[model samples]
Target: MAQFYTAKQRVTTKQRITVTIEDLDPFGQGVARHQGKTIFVSGALPGEQAEITLTEDKRQFARAKVTRLLSSSPARVTPRCPHFNTCGGCQQQHVDVVLQQQSKAQALSRMLSKEAQRVVAVDEVIAGEPWGYRRRARLGLQWQNKSQQLRMGFRQEASNDLVDIQQCPILTPELEALITPLRQCLRELKAVKRLGHVELVQADNGPLMVLRHLDALHVDDREKLERFSHKHQLMMFLDDGSENLTALSNNQPFYQSHKLKLTFSPQDFIQVNDAVNQQMVARAIDWLDLQPDDRVLDLFCGMGNFTLPIGKVVQNAVGVEGVAALVRQAAYNADLNSLKNVSFFQHNLEEDVSRQPWAAQGFNKVLLDPARAGAAGVMTHVVKLAPQRVVYVSCNPTTLARDSQTLLLAGYQLERVAMLDMFPHTRHLESMVLFKKT
Candidate 1:
């Protein structure tokens, strides 16, 4: 009972004070202050003065919602997309690109310092073409049969309700053109009740859509889909409970990349922005500085995006993934590219990987690209591998910070880190770090 006892604190509203944003928080909120306490403000940017209404006042930090921008920074720019505020797809579009990258780097450094008691240096920002870079998107569909109204888009910020989007400029022209027709296709279906959502995927030749249905499609509905697929030259997938290939429609996926050809299933997780993804892959491989005798290990390798390329430079490389389907695809990509030294396997990476055959082998370099949770479970195995260098790609700054601490404990020093503006006009920042075994 004594151990649970703590100091008594009373709650009271402090005098409202306006402050300029100094940085970005982990959740993409802006960091501001009043009277020595930090305030997390939504929709505010660094170096911008804003009037905010206090939502919650705590012992350390306060929560605020921006009421008005008193003075906008010169770095702020007008967002292109009309759904900027309504659609929850992106954040940080209001901030300039350079400042955005700087804020993200600071966030990474701060989180790492707290976790590891060391500062990580972030390299130059890797940016791409700001617009029309998204190759694929899974749009939400909600059709009101009685009202004859259809809403097809992502949900609004902090709400479950959908946003009606008539046009999307960020996607390829072919994909953007299908949004209207796809909606019409669902409306004309004989069994519209069975329809749930449509997955629009951009490919080499055209767009492929997989319709997820609650019930099986009727004969007329099937015919309508066939006709649409034929007329638009679209590859259509109908899934009642399972994926099915009803008609043989060939629509190749079109990828606009100079060096890398990335192929992925719409259902699979591929970086939505093609341009930035290519830049990221190129930068990672370039920083690795591979040699002929080098052997590399790619952890959380998704469809061999980085594995196959690393295999190109080194004597041999191995990719480990959790999903069998992706492992199979990665192997196929290696074979298709005629890359002799590359191999892939499927294993649950969250568990111990020491039992694997390659655990005993030594690699000159290693690359880790994990999900938002980051790669905490494999740090011990990574250290055991004892590569000369390690490159980590991360989505979440908090998890990245924690993992950096683990790497630091294993005798690696943060050499360089770079923020990639993969999801621009949004708060999400992609970062990469290189560590040298010290």
Candidate 2:
């Protein structure tokens, strides 16, 4: 007996067509029109012709992959990394960095302008060295049973698989040099099967590595890690998925920003680009037009990146953060810098802070750097606080545009907006804006 497949039970066939890419979107996808419908091609660039295969079809638009390139754009450059196509680390490797920044800036301007109901021009696009700027990275680790070896690198794109990267060009030279030796050490470990992931960071002091494991390590394996750390002159830590860390060495890990030395653990969050961050901090401080008598409030202030610097120039500064660990670290950082005028508080930003002790003292200037979700409800508080100047730093444009309406309605003019090329060769966009009371 034979079975016949019905239309509903059959898999949808892929549609292939040739189209001209007219524009590039913020996500690094190429925009094209085919048969009166918009098509998004992943690996295609603007002003290029290519045959594409439709992966997803919808009523208004479709997603596609480039099959063959009929023509290439002048801006196209050969990717430096061998795993650029397969590794999910970077998306715009094929395109030059300058063009990449231009496209993102245009998208940001259009979105911010549309949301503000007025033409908003990007004052400047803050960019730094295109490559070797990523000071921190997390390399995924997986042990292959059949092969009896360890695989290390970034995860594969659109799949659970991993790409064994030999060289990552985006990492700083110090960190990239440790990749081979680090992998070899882990592969030789007796507890390799329990290995989870390896985090690499290059601090100004030295390189630091964190090895996350699911089980305990044998004494011999621990000795090997210590020897490796000593030989490489880097700090190493072992994590069992907790705040407690077993140090393999005795040196503290710290980085310098705006001439301030801040100590952070291996698992703590810090900006990956050191140069851009320092420049951004200088620009933000200058944009506020700081005065001698201004009392400042810094919200979502992770590790006192801005508050400590602001405190040096202002009368008093208060930094508030949601994470207790970060708040403690920020306060420690303030003391380390000998900044007695600055203070830190651990409070959830979503809740009203009017009753808090820190809120009793009014703030004339404010700064907030929120995650991608973009600080909602906080804008209303800012309005009530009636700060003369407010600085909002954001990583997601969609949320920034939505939140801008709140401040605009509160009679705060969007003074200046600058796109920060924090992560080059990737689609991540970070920007900061200044809002002044009308």
Candidate 3:
């Protein structure tokens, strides 16, 4: 067990130390060691020297904030966003793009090494166009009574406090331009006080604003929204008791191009970066290499993003999701897309899949897109199924490493791994790996 620092001990002690930033943690924080204990410092880059103030010291590790950069790495760059420190949206904006990819790949490799007892090499990071990539976002609206101003943006790191942002360089230009107008709508609406949150979805067409209101909307507020939507030509949705939306009588959703045409709902979880996501999905399918007679299993499939496309080339595809609603939606997406070979089923994959009937079947290939908590329990089942090849798309490297160990233990060999720059200007990395049974 690790020792816990008492409140009295924490308040009395202040330690000042200079340490060389050794590496970056999975969360994009710089890591350093002093007296054989680890400390995490924000805004510090590897190969840089910095002064750190210990905020919380535990038996095994400590947390800290960088007070001064004694030396800076050449890879460091000025952050594009003014709210880089306060807003928790993008952490690695200050780091060079090439360095960010290296950090992420190293983080994944380290985690996998610890669990697998073997060196794992991560492929070069996939690059995407940096700006105007974010297509989906949920903007927080907070009316600061003292300032008497409405703030529209994300929350500060480690606090419920909202960071008032005038513009976000990380978001698409279309979405960033809406920040001021969104606040204007709030200012005009008397019932904006009842608004819980606002969702901004950028379909290929244009931006769609879904206002989630907790209380009833007054007639004047509704009229204000209608007028704003009409003048700006925006598609607006008001959430009453249900998520059912009534598009503003005057405006329609914008369409960008036929190639990128995609629809989104307020409640659905869409990838924030549109351009990179399209590439990421395409890469997954390409790596899977679906054949006409191939059977594919998409674990943790959400809304058939990958399943429907893979189904187009395979004999049949089954998408299993934890949420029943998502499974239904995925099935609906298959039907809507005229994909005949795709089907969806709800299954609690975190738990044992051996109990499920579908678990008994073997497939020629499998595609997994698990959450930050990677597919731990399902890896064993995957080994037993022993598909010729397995393609895994991961959001978190630590969990991916642990699961990689499970696969290795089950006699699967890691063939190749590559990082996808889905969320640029951030420490967040989306990666894919291919595995084959030994």
Candidate 4:
């Protein structure tokens, strides 16, 4: 008898609402309120009024897409790329480049402050070229049955449909120029149906392309790929989800930073933006205040990007990576650079690393460049090493905040924090924070 009545479900009407954007969320979505609930609107900016149609509605917040713009912000500008609105590659393209960096920096500072439960000041935003800076990209390939053509480009926002792009302004000139030619070559290839994805990298040597296929190519298809490689003067490789990289060209692919050349395979993970990467490395070294006789540890070291550079200045530097191949490559790179004092170890950082022999070594300084998951599990073991200084480079702020809380609780105080605009015009945020043991 007490539970006789049942509450009716609230119906969400798909109606357009006009609201003034008050702020920008971390993902560059405009924040507004409707019916006492928060709503995030895409393609809308702060201090602007727009008519938005709700795309999603939840108990706490809703998501919407801007259908009409009643007013515009002074910070708004025309996007440079023709596929800006359709392509999912870049967000915040309509906002001024400088404003984009500032917004990201502010967002990061607020996040860190909240996480640390104290006021945190953000240093000047480190930025580079806003366009044509992307040196690496994984392009999608789709066979369009309706047009009897193969579409090559990034996927549309929130859709699997590929945005057939002739050229992407964000890609380096060398890589951008290959788009049309690569498309044509793929269309002519007999192995077109087996194609999975195409990767383009503007290496220090030259443009290196990797064609991923589901199955092996025939002799004729291989000959065609060779011809394409020769015509474009590009180093090419073929990958079929195998560990080995089949070379299509003899030319080696490499990149340079901090006066060191790093040779890598097409499948290797390297920073896409070289300019920002160099700056970030230099700043990391400067902030660490490396001593000539000090020992340093570089965790999640990929092919010695930070490891080799730090090794050059330190008495002893040890690089640790989860991948065995990367660990071997790190050692090779160290040797290539004539860095005799560097060493590398292969271990899974997410697991218990305290038992590792290298973990017992004392380190005065530590540098962590972890992926989005952050170095939470590794931090526990790292604390045992008791490094005097720790510098964390993070691509995702949420994880950084979580890890920073752990570091703070472990008697580390944040010294300096800065944002690196590694990927401009996108919601991705890269930040570096220095922590000193209290």
Candidate 5:
């Protein structure tokens, strides 16, 4: 079937309207009500008046971007990044950091309170330096055929287009200094057309680099990358979209959490904010109130971030991960730390875990740091395990609230919840929850 649009159905010019910003929503957009319809205004802050141009329209709500700010909020701050408006790397840089934390904490509390069918408030907020705290970043590459130039930066807001950036304010100082030189180096490569993206990480030892290439690099291009690595004195890894990563240096990158060093490959997952991560680990351990005779089980334990620390204080610590590679690395990290009481196991938490060898043992204290999807498949098993205490570290609050239902129904209490200001100047929020069977 074919359809044709009539004159009435033809595209019309954008609609602009004036509205008073009421509040900031979960995604950091300003909330406004216009003629009884909910309007989400971007680049607008609470307690501000603005003229907005509609970007999206629906029956119940509409999305708009501010064209003119007739008024501004007292909490508004000047954004540090020049690309902050166009780049999608961060969203809340224009808003005050303290207000950002307050808004997010309120939202998190409401979400958890509703999910748990009881009042749940954030007991504490773990925060650090609002800028230059990020230890990891991935910049995209867009190669221009006619100009033979490679534009390296983050993606544009809500688009695939790259926002060419000289430096990002959120990245650590070490990684930030390499951005211009890295862009220049990528443009110098003969295999620019095959370039994918570049990942930078600020390890405790030094900065690290990873280049994702669609195809194998030429001899000269590889040498050029080597020279760049040599000049910066950072470890370099070339990823060909596979498990086999080509390393240009023998040095391994490592980071510290709870005073334990965790060695990981460029492929492994590590927290982007080192300060918040360390504080978070300490808080979780403190909340658990670990006893010397107790045992702890860490779910979704990647490279033994929390598991290694738990091992030091408990009689035994068992770390479980779905990825075999991470499990192996977690075990190696424990061994490297000389923690003989710690063990790592690889098992899919989505499946029946009672049948697994690791689940046969009794774990009095359990800590699970699942990804954004949350531990839906393992919540029942976690409840069944009958752990006296559980510390859940989550990157997504909706999923955290969703999974907390099982714990609540199983007679566990939401003791303490903390909002982790892990990624400032962004809508992304991380949290730590303590559930104790008291």
Candidate 6:
């Protein structure tokens, strides 16, 4: 008879185990094997030996927290963030930055090769400043009853407890400078208890701070926020459970890429890293080898981030998005930029959209920038369009690999691929790949 063990029973049985780290998982955790079972250990790097305590035990694999570093890897470095050990915002800060990029690129290449069943050569690793590149961040807020103060910062690693950090190195200097003043302003608000989350964005025009609250702010609270905005020379907005955003200041928040303007709402999705995004958009345009007469399709296009820029060079560009609001904004951006060749349509790409009018329009090139849930549903319809080239921009390697297999099966050959270091000191990997019809 086979024996089974509960998580507690297994931990009590093993207590602690020392093992050599073999490799790293996509999340940058050290991978090790013990007693014919896989163990994932945090804060341990490849080529290191560590003693770990089991935190979770499953039938297939177990999760552990490193207790002692028996042997340290050469590539390991002291993390710069003072709260690196506690803050959950970053993962690879302990590893050397160059080594982190190389490891990520290798992992991405391996995934693509395994999924597509062909040798995938990574062309280049697109990288920029590793720190202070993040232009947007959402911070958690909590009232400490004992101190009668508000705790503001990111959450703890793997826990919901907010880390009271005074400054974050990952955020742009303009946004980081407001951390202290923002906290002070929140403390003065009578509706501070109603505060849910704080979002800070460094738009191209200026900095914008958004305060989300579960309840409406009092008149005094709004005045306090306005003062803070004026003092910091930043725009302020309030979201009080209403679907619309109420501006406390007259400034509008927007960002520019490729000489094109893009206005976004406080809650709308935009790439957090500005420099990396510019390079990514340029690469996508170059890889498509777009021509004056070429018609292009951009799937999951958000607020014309890529659509308006690509529309400038192509004969006609069509962008499809799931959210109608974003589609409306994209169209507005096209008209704002005087790009008449671009058009946007609202359609849920997760379902069959082959019957949609835009789907029937022949496009010689297609660009995909889907969320972590890759573009599987839209790929079938895309195949029907038979675009000559397909460019895939992925945030999740696992999903990218899954969708790559689908594309390979549809007679598309994976030609060029690269990794973009969009989020440094983090496990998140942003990559781009080009597929050409054989």
Candidate with the greatest TM-score versus the true structure: 2
**Residue-level lDDT tens digits of model 2 in 339-419:** 999999999988887788887688999998998988895777878889999989889999999988998999999999999
Error of 5 at 376 (Å): 0.9
Between prediction 1 and prediction 4, the one with superior lDDT is 4
Clashing pairs in 2: none
lDDT of 4 at 125: 80
TM-score of every prediction relative to native: 0.89, 0.97, 0.90, 0.95, 0.96, 0.94
Q: How does model 5 fare in lDDT?
A: 0.91
**Cα lDDT of model 3 by residue, 1-438, tens digit:** 999986764456578899999987656788898989988988888888998899998999998888888998998898888899899888888888777777777877777667767787886566678777887788887777788777778998888888988898877788888888778779778876666778877766566788877788888888889887777666788887674766665444432221322334556666666566667777777777768999899999887777877887889899999987677767766776677778888988989888786776668798899999889868888888889889888998767877877777777788878887888767676788888877
Q: How good is model 3 by TM-score? A: 0.90
lDDT of each: 0.79, 0.90, 0.79, 0.90, 0.91, 0.90
Q: Clashing residue pairs, candidate 4?
A: none
Q: Residue 256, candidate 1: how far off, in angstroms?
A: 7.8
RMSD of each: 6.1, 1.8, 5.2, 4.3, 2.7, 4.3
Candidate 1 residue pairs that clash? 91-426, 91-427, 123-417, 203-253, 203-254, 204-252, 204-253, 204-254, 205-252
Candidate 2: RMSD to truth:
1.8
Instruction: Give the per-residue lDDT digits (tens) of candidate 4, residues 1-438.
Output: 476877999997788999999988667788899889999999899999999999988999999999999999998999998999789999888988877887788899999999889989897688789889999999988887788889899998889989989889889999999999899999998878768889999998899888998887989999999999999999989998988989977887888888888988787899999989999999999999998999999999988899999988989999999989888888888888899999999988999887788887889899999999999889887788889999999999999999998889999999999999999888999999999999
Q: What is the C-alpha RMSD, rounded to one decimal, of candidate 3? A: 5.2
Model with the higher lDDT, candidate 1 or 2: 2
What ordering of candidates by TM-score runs from best to worst? 2, 5, 4, 6, 3, 1
The candidate that achieves the highest lDDT relative to the unseen native structure:
5
What does candidate 6's lDDT look like per residue over 305-355, in tens digits? 888999999999999999988998889889989999999999999998977
lDDT, candidate 3, residue 130?
Answer: 79
Q: For residues 113-212, could you state the per-residue lDDT of candidate 5 as single tens digits?
A: 9988778889989999998999999899999888777889999877999988988989999999999888888888888888899989999999999999
Question: What is the lDDT for 137 in model 1?
Answer: 80
